[model samples]
Target: MIKILKYTEYLYLAVAIASIYKIITLWGVAQQETYIFIFFAVISIAMFLFRRNYRRKFEKRKQDNQN
Candidate 1:
């Protein structure tokens, strides 16, 4: 379960990276679409942070329970 959480956290980072690439590629060609990708990039980064924090807290709780 912890491994799964870790993978998903990185997956969000991957999405953010991809969104940034798309934004860069389409910045001038498709202004409206670039805006959408920008939004996605921001949300993906936010989710990545949120998930990481949650995972850390979960791991800490599990460790405490083991003692």
Candidate 2:
């Protein structure tokens, strides 16, 4: 479970980095590109939040099971 969480954290980090790169490179582009980058950034944030909640739930369940 911990291993799974660790991997998820890494994936979230990667998505964030990619979004940052996209925004940086597209900052000077047209509004359409800017909007697209923003969309990707939002999705990245949502993914991270979901992963965090999922890990927390998994940990709680594991503890409950052990008890």
Candidate 3:
């Protein structure tokens, strides 16, 4: 489960990167709508943040249990 959560964090980061790339490329063409990419980037960022927090909490709990 922890490994899966870690994978998801990376996935979100990847999505964010892809969204940024889309915005950059589209900006050059000036022919594509960017709201969808922006929305995806926002969602990806949020998910990554949430997962980071959750992972930290889990690590804290594990440390407490060990101590």
lDDT of 3 at 39: 86
Q: In terms of TM-score, which candidate is strongest?
A: 1
Expressed as tens digits, the lDDT of each residue in 13-41 for candidate 2 is: 68777877888888887668878877877
Error of 3 at 66 (Å): 2.5
Number of the predicted model whose lDDT against the real structure is largest: 1
Each model's lDDT comes to 0.99, 0.81, 0.88
Cα lDDT of model 1 by residue, 1-67, tens digit:
9999999999999999999999999988999999999999999999999999999999999999999
Instruction: Give candidate 3 regions above 4 Å deviation.
Output: 28-32
lDDT value, candidate 2, whole model:
0.81
Where does model 1 exceed 4 Å of error? Answer: none
Q: What is the lDDT of residue 1 in candidate 3?
A: 75
| Residue 9 lDDT (model 3) | 94
What TM-score against the true fold does each predicted structure earn? 0.98, 0.76, 0.83
lDDT of 1 at 61: 100
